[model samples]
Structure formats: structure tokens, C-alpha cells
Target: MDNKINFKDLWAKQTSIEPNPGDLLLQISKMKRSNLRKLIVTNLMLVTVSAFIILIWIYYQPQLVSTKVGILLIILSMTIFLFAYNRSYTLFKEDINSKSNTDYLKELLAIKSKQQFMHTTMLNVYFILLSAGIGLYMYEYTSRMTIFWGIVAYGITLIWILFNWFYLRPKQIKKQQLKLDDMITKFKKLNNQLEA
Candidate 1:
């Protein structure tokens, strides 16, 4: 019996095969892209709201100390948001440009991890500054209701920071790092196969 493999048939069979590790990595990358998009949109909204508040303060209470302080806080928040927004955008673009699958996957995961850390840090900083600014405003305005709300807001922000640090961030980082390691192992296996 003569045995001969048809190249086209083999190619078609391979194409029809169920997706494996590589496809999963691509799916993860797409999910990351979507997540980054959502983050950018949310940051834009925050920036817009902050700008609106500053505009209102400028028009209504240009000379008020509380308004001035609010403006400063808004500016600080915007700056932090901008840093995260721009870094994420750049990383997304770079990931899109990467031609090698393994390299792209590794770089994308690193970028995502870094972006998460930076985003959290910026948010924590913004909340802390917000708490201080709000507290100052309440004290200067001499309103019991304002002071109560400010304290509540500060408490909520502190709790958020604690929850993120203790519960969310560590788990997220570990998950991402595990994914990256798996991808690396798969890549090494593929390389070894090619060598063999």
C-alpha cells in the first residue's frame, strides 16, 4: 500500500481543528483591549465632570476660598487621570503593532498589569486629595451638613483603598501573572517542538 499525504488536505484539517492555547491567548488579549477601552471612556467622563465643576466654580464663586480649593483638587485629579489614560492608550497601540504572537502576549500582559497598578495608585491619590479638599471646604463653609457628608465621603474612600489593596489588587495581579507564565511555557513548548 502506497501512502501519500495531500498538503491541501492537511492544511484544511489543521484549519478546522479546535482552537488551542494560542486562541485562548488571543481571546484574553481582546478582553484586555475591551477593558482598556472602558477605562479610557470612564476616565474621559471623569475629566469632563471635573472640568464642568471647575467651570461652574469659576463663573459662580471665583473669589471663594472653597471654590479655589475645589479647582485645585479638580486639576490634580485630572492630571492623574490623564497620566493613566495616556499610558493605557500607548500600551494598547503598541500591543496592536506587535507582530510576534508570544512577544505580543507577554508585552500586553505586562502593560495591563502596569496599567492596573498605575490606575489604582492614581485613584487612591485622587480620593485622598478629594477627602482633604472636601474636609477643608466643609470647615471653611461652617456647615454641619457639609461636614457630615465630607466625613462620610472620606470614610468611603478610605474603605475603597483598603478593600482594593487587601482583596482586589493582589488577586488580580496573581491571576494575570499566572496567565503570562502559562503563555510563556506554551511558547517554550512550541519552540522546542520546532527544534525537534
Candidate 2:
């Protein structure tokens, strides 16, 4: 008839507990598959857009040297980004046959490092090249419009770029960082348990 709660029973009955190794591994696998799918989709979309741009260039046959340069810059930026991004694919491919947790951890660390570089430096370069390319490309068409309309067009473009840079980019980076960090932390816990 004692009213006092038993600490042992309370602890034992607690529902919130750390994920088991099998569950953790399953989650990691699922995340990996999801990430791989996202990577493929992103690459495919970029390639399709590049092809569309090339088709437009061939069909429209822009006369201005600036227009040609602009198109080249856009395509070059996409190519560079894709190349950098795709290099990480090897890590995913190799991870399947990873011999040990240590090897998998190493791969995860390498991926995190690469993603940091992509999120920061490579992304900045891509955005800069894209902005410059768009500006140059728009000149040919905008030149035929009234000054006010030209200004409006440029302003709209600038605003859109700014919104993506200041808002969307940070949000996306944070989201991805959180996901990777969670997986890394969980993997580290599992690794420590194995080591101990």
C-alpha cells in the first residue's frame, strides 16, 4: 500500500530508449537510398536543362558573342557542379561492401567533408556563374524592350536569385546537414559499442 513510486520500475518502463544496432543500420540504409535517389534526380534534371539550353542555342542561333559566352558559362557551371557532385557516388557504391564499421565511418566522414565543400564553395561558384550567365543572356532580349521594362526584368531576376541564396539555400543546407549529422552520430555510437 506504499504510495512512493519505484525508481527501478519507472526506469524499466520508460518507452524512450536508444535505437538498437539493427534499427540504426536499417535507418542508415534507408537514408542512403533516399539520398542516392535525390542525387540521381538532381543530376538528371540538370542534364535535361543543359540539353534544353543547347537545343535552344542551336535552334534560335543567337548572333551576339555575349549570348554565346553566356550559354557556355551556364553549361560549364552545370558541368563543373555535376562533376564535383558525382565524385561522391563512388563512396556510395563502395559503401555496400564495406568490410567493417570503421570503413563505413570513414566513408561517411569523407562524404560529410565533400558535402561541406559542395554546400559552401562549389555552391557559391555555381550561383555566381549562373547569375552572370543569366544577366548576359537577358541583355540581348531586354535590349529590345523599353528601359523601364528592362529594369523590371533585371530586378525580378535579381530578387529571385537573392531569395534563393538568402532563404532557400540556407534552409536546404541546414536540412541536409541535420540528416547527415544524425546518421553520423548514430553510427559513431554503434561503432563505439562494437569497439568496446
Candidate 3:
């Protein structure tokens, strides 16, 4: 009777172990890559829009002549570009690299969740500020024609707020929270294995 344990069998069992950490990291990394791509695309679009607006303002410099209002719009557009630029830069700066597979997965999840939260909060705050700024501009620039432009600006602000509330923010928060939950599950499993 073979009473001695076979090292070969133990090795075989270990070799067949599931790659849970690796699989999760791969999934998370893929999601992050897609998100990064989306951010880049959005930033590019914002920059392009800002540039086009500036060009239009310059080209029609004579007719649409309200130096203060034009200046305010230009500043507002630049601010939007700056916000988008900063977000993209931060995302790039926080790219994930970890010493261990477990650490890598955890860090990646943390960074992604943080980024999502920061973006949603910043966007909401920005839209509120924008709405307020537009309202002030309309108040200051009131005239027969100002009514039409004021309504247009207010409409744009309302659309932005509605879009963020109905679409962007909820989606971002839900996705990030789901990722966080997955990471917590993995962490708990790792802790259990260590305790065992």
C-alpha cells in the first residue's frame, strides 16, 4: 500500500487551479482601456468644438458684437476644455501597474472607480455653474434680441443638466460601484484563503 503522498499529484492539482485573479484583471483592464479611449475621444471632440466656436466668434466679429458676452462665452468654452483636459491627464497619470496580480487588480479597480466618481461630480458641478453663469449673462444682457439668445442659452443649460441627471451620472456610478463590489469579493476570497 502506497502510504506516501505523491508530489506529482499535488503539482498536477495546483497546475489545474483556476486563474481567478488573472481573469479578473484582464476583464478590468479591458474595461479601463475602453473607458480611456472614450475619454480621449470626448476630450478631442471638446477641443474641436471650442476651436470651432472661437473661429466663428472671430469670423463674425463685427455683427455679433457684444465684447463682454463674447468674452464670457469664450472663457466658458475654454473652461470646459480645461476640465476635459485635466480629466484625461489624470486618467493617463493613474495608469495601473502592480507588483502582484492581486494588487494589480485591486489598484486598477480603485483607480477606475475613483475616476468615475470624480468625473460625475465634476460634471454635475460644472453644469450647475454653467447654468448660473448663463442666467447671470442673460440678466445683464437683456434686450429684445437678448430674450431669444437668453432662452437658447438656458435651453442648452437645461439640456446639459437633464442629460447628466438622466444618463451620464447614474450610469457611471452604477458601473463603478459594480466594479468595486467585484473587487471586494475578490479581496474577501483572498483573505479567506490566507486565513485557511
Instruction: List candidate 3 segments past 4 Å from native.
Output: 1-3, 7-40, 60-98, 101-113, 133-142, 146-160, 166-168, 181-185, 188-196
Error of 1 at 149 (Å): 10
Model 1 alpha-carbon drift over 4 Å, by segment: 1-9, 12-44, 59-67, 143-196
**TM-score of every candidate relative to the true structure:** 0.51, 0.67, 0.51
Once all C-alphas are superposed, what RMSD does model 3 give against the true structure? 7.1
Candidate 2 per-residue lDDT over residues 1-196, each given as its tens digit: 7879798998988686677989989999999999889898989999999999999999999988888889988998898789877875664566445466677666666677677677677777887888888888888988889999999999999999899789977887788778877877876787687678
lDDT digits (tens) for residues 1-196 of candidate 3: 7869897888877656567998899999999999779777876876786677667557756333454464465458457646755764676465466346666655665665666566556556655555555445444444545667868866876788678767876786578668766776776676566456
lDDT-sorted candidate list, best first: 2, 1, 3
Which one is best on lDDT?
Answer: 2
Residue range 1-196, candidate 1, lDDT tens digits: 5468777787876645576988899999999999878877978887787788777766766555775786677567677767766776676675355457656555655665576576557656765676555555444444435767867765775687667666776676577567756766675666566456
* Global local distance difference test of model 2: 0.82
**Poorly placed runs, candidate 2 (over 4 Å):** 1-42, 185-196
lDDT-wise, the better of 1 and 3 is 1
